[model samples]
Target: MTQTIAIDNSQKLQLAPLDIPNRLLLGPGPSNAHPAVLEAMNTPPVGHLDPAFLGLMDEIQSLLRYTWQTQNQLTIAVSGTGTAAMEATIANSVEPGDVVLIGVAGYFGNRLVDMAGRYGADVRTITKPWGQVFSLSELRTALETHRPAILALVHAETSTGARQPIDGVGDLCREFGCLLLLDTVTSLGGVPIFLDTWGVDLAYSCSQKGLGCPPGASPFTMSQRAVEKLQQRKTKVANWYLDMNLLGKYWGSDRIYHHTAPINLYYALREALRLLAQEGIENSWQRHQKNVEYLWAGLEDIGLKLHVQQEFRLPTLTTVCIPDGVDGKAIAKILLNDYNIEVGGGLGELAGKVWRVGLMGFNSRTESVDRLLEVLPQVLSK
Candidate 1:
């Protein structure tokens, strides 16, 4: 048999420049990055262990504390996305056979239950109807029944655009010997977050939503009580990378090695925090609130309806019901393809029924509000 050797001639692929549209992102998350934030992302990368990089990390943590309004010592940015920090917090806090009470008010609330279950927790959920807030009576009853090791709730439920009340629930969790875990990814920089005053033991958030930074970093804080509980845990955290013990060393003064931090994302996050500080947290909240009003005013004029009630709607994100005879997904497609604007379709149980419109951070300006409002009538007419 004569064997013929064939030469491989596959060409190395050439990189192509991506041509992106000038989109006004009015979607659920990744609203819009300020120009300053984009510039920050262009900064040169530095080694994770370099003194300058470590210094930047320290500043990032301090700014996150200011943004979160928490003085918790165990505060830092997880190197991945929002869900990473949320999973880390739960996996570190709950051990096998532990009971966790999750408040399922909307889509993100159900995510809490799933995360807790992944850590071998017996997840007991207290659910409210979509677009509704949990009543104090219902919460109190669930607390008495479950007596869980942790009480988890979403401060701003992104899917339903509902804001859950935190004051009473935080106090109840503390009184019932349950650590309070809050998901504030959509509420952190755009709203008032008094983590220390509210008795939140641990909270996690993302930069893409309210912070107006690109996706990649998850900002999280852990109260002293949560820290002590982790220290006393009988078993090691299931996930090694998210292990609070090792992560603490990297984020704390000890400065031990954990993983290679995403330098450019940190750069963008730092600038985002700087912008938030310049705006002032209270003022940022008011900005979102004002734009939400403007959105509702325009929406009502167009004969559209909001999904969540006025009293409980999230200022940063709004869920609007798709009008009859119009397809929600089709409207979104028109906005993206024709208008160069992006808004989210519904999620979970509310899928295809509602549209999620986010007035977050840099995207909360009057111009953005006007752009979406003006284009809506045209989109709906088709």
Candidate 2:
């Protein structure tokens, strides 16, 4: 049954039908979702705890394990964006007055320092210039000097398009008895991230970028050691909604009610992970690398300079130095308005000096790269 109310002309709302333009996403995140993923999102909703949904949850966890390349039992998708997962990891692991050391090189690294401090940790930061990554020795010295409980770093810094190398940093954490927390928001599926082999105790990422799903559900994992730290925490987690212990109960076998999970978003994530599995994680990594190389070559051919060096460049996102006398914002607007292509501008210290371009997940294709290359020069010239 339905009821309708008649309203005066003055009272009537001026709402119109919704219409969204089709734009190619070549920005830092929220990359174009796969067709199958979008279809899955449109599927009929189910109760979060329904039997069928629970089965789907199990499948998601299994697939997440495969994607993260870890056997950590606490691996699950947090109920919010990547930042929520970041908060969860920090709030659960850091107690009041605990010392935390962060390797800061870009915007997200600074974000980690802020989050850790808000959790009542004494934050110590060792920073390099935005486009440069910390060396292994620098990390070792920081850990030895700060003697913090956790050493956090960003695996792929989106702001500056720099990739931090973590080959031996984990061993240094072990020597100093510090837990290793990493932000993989841009690198998870697009790059090689072996959580266990790399000794990452805690890690978090988003679905929108590398997972090729809409933003909402975030991938999160914690090693057994991290779980032990949470179990032994003296104080209640600062944030209730992001409490890992409570979230673990809901995401784990207990299946207790925490909140109404974003049912459709989970559906989309499941399909996205399935697509990744079908393509093979290694193959996905190779695809991103190959596509980015092509993009770099094209940009170079057009006389554009990349901000990051070749050795430590991020494959998923690249920072193009804005040529002198060219307005970065204008170029981005022209591309969006005239070409229906979306790209990102710089953040923090790099603003107006560079443009952040991303080729992630579904957008990491030769065709998309070629289209951007074709329009980029025209946009810059204008």
Candidate 3:
């Protein structure tokens, strides 16, 4: 038996009103959410399997196809962040003791090796120093020598804001009888992730970065050949929840229950993708490119140097070297507390040496860039 609280006593319970200041998000991820996305999240909840909700799911998949520039039938949103999608891709791709070749450029590539290793893959990496990219010859040599089951790479290295060129990698992987898995978490909507055109076998992205949505959902797509590899796995996938085969059944024609889908989050991402569709992927990509250039110009004018090489720098995110005699974290702290502008610190080997600045999706605009440029110097002085 439970006792009910008296109305008089309940009235005396002090509750501080929630206070959240408006902030300009220009960090590595979790960029400012579009108003449409927030409104969609406020919509009344519906059952995941409801006829209306199922239609929404179908639309989400279609919109993801547009965003990813692919016609793949297996595209769907995983109920987690970017790493979850990465883990799911690796977990589903190779079974125990399978050999895999990973290109290690920055932090995310190393993560792919770990994810594959967890599934008992014998991981070998063709390594490049931080803030650098591997030459095609080096990658090809490794691929030919290892002849592994999969070639894993991070399309955008968030740690150093370096973008890897994959123009010939997919063809090379195919020639070497290997599958290509790519991490596009920070690159997807902000740049071109031409999955079908590039012949990529597997790709994954997160909602927080380029999608301008909250971080709960991760969108992933796998080619038919990649699906075949999963089907032929001798052992069941180690991760039950992220097992793509069973997930396909639920997300496929059957619509069977594997787990309770986060209905509200799906609503949020669906509306986010709807906005992206309206904007058109190519236009959105161009907008990101333009804004990032503007940001680079301002940073250069202010005497800040870019860490990544000009040819490999990521358009959505820029890693800037901290000026001599200035404290990176201190400047970021001042900007956040005093100006309500949030930026990011570096990660892994780049930490304390650079600042990762993001111009992604809804936050990629002239006003946002201008405001940051205007205030950054002032914050740095103090």
Candidate 4:
């Protein structure tokens, strides 16, 4: 059932087949997807509400719970990128004029401030320099001063390449009678995240970073307390598209239609989560750490300095300071054009001063690390 269009004789159309280069993705996100994941995406599309699709939906939720290490009944994948889930978290829980305190150590933390403000939250912030994270005592002091209704933090700050410690932040939020929300966009499958144990009331992550899938669907979860907050909201959620109250019904037993779910992306995510489960989550974390150690040592041997301290550095992403008299953008360009390797440049305050390298999910391997170290020297010399 293809339709033919009439075109004028003077009109010239340029159309061709699409082709992309084979690249080693060592960037901040959208890492190299697994072979199985790609194949899964090619499966024939099914109606979003079909019985077979509904069964797959159930399985996806189950695997997401396992991947996130939580028993939250509200765990499901949103139909957009990581930022969509972030908005859902804020929109649902933050009514008009609610005080929200956000920790700003990097770009994504700054993003929380903007998103919450759009939802009519009275946003307050405590900030440190780009490569540093706040201490539990500092957080406690902020809570005592502002006493916000919500306290949000980024678990792994992708822009600065720092992993914020969450061992006691959740307990402190509880003591202060505040709900905890976390952004795990770069840490979900690459690191250890215990939503229930860490008392994370709400959390969200992307598919492309640690899940080894294309960037489309996002993982989201809410604790019972967060659900209760939603239940008691005085005002309607500002954003209609990202309202979790409606999303919950669509993902829950009601099976009500909110929107057309991204069926193929969900298929890919299911396979990727299956791969993680097969490898064992703990094993995956250790693998990322080991690979990052190799990369760090290699970078140092080649006279490059890491931007963040070793203890707080994120294993999934690393920020390397640009050497004196070297062009950071040139390095990334040459790597892509000449070596067919892709890496990320700095962001926000660290722009032009550092390069962001990622070793996430399927891309975190000894061979990938060794390959980058092997060619980086040659590229730098020329």
Cα RMSD for candidates in order: 2.7, 2.5, 2.8, 2.3
- Could you tell me the lDDT of residue 217 within candidate 3? 85
TM-score of candidate 3 versus the correct structure, residues matched by position: 0.96
Question: Mind giving the per-residue lDDT tens digits that candidate 1 earns over 145-170?
Answer: 99999988889999999998888777
Candidate 2 per-residue C-alpha lDDT over 88-172 given as tens digits, one digit per residue, 9 for 90 to 100? 8898899999999998899999999989988899999999999999998889888878999999999999999999998888888
Which portions of model 2 miss their true places by more than 4 Å? 1-13
Cα lDDT over the full model 2: 0.92
- Count backbone clashes in candidate 2: 0
Candidate 3: the clashing residue pairs are none
How high is the lDDT of residue 103 in model 4?
A: 97
Q: Give Cα-based local distance difference scores for all models.
A: 0.90, 0.92, 0.89, 0.93
Model 1 residue 177 lDDT score: 90
- In candidate 1 the C-alpha lDDT for residue 255 amounts to 94
Least well predicted 10-residue stretch by lDDT in candidate 2: 1-10
Per-residue lDDT over 313-381 for candidate 3, one digit per residue giving the tens place of the 0 to 100 score? 888999999998989999998999999999999888888999989999899999999999999988877
Q: List where candidate 4 sits over 4 angstroms from the true fold.
A: 1-13
Deviation (Å) of 151 in candidate 2? 0.2
Candidate 1 TM-score versus the reference: 0.96
TM-score of 4: 0.97
Which scores greater on lDDT, model 1 or model 2?
2
Write model 4 residue lDDT over 272-373, tens digit each, in one string: 999999999999999999999999999999999999999999999999999888999999999999898899999899999999999998999999899999
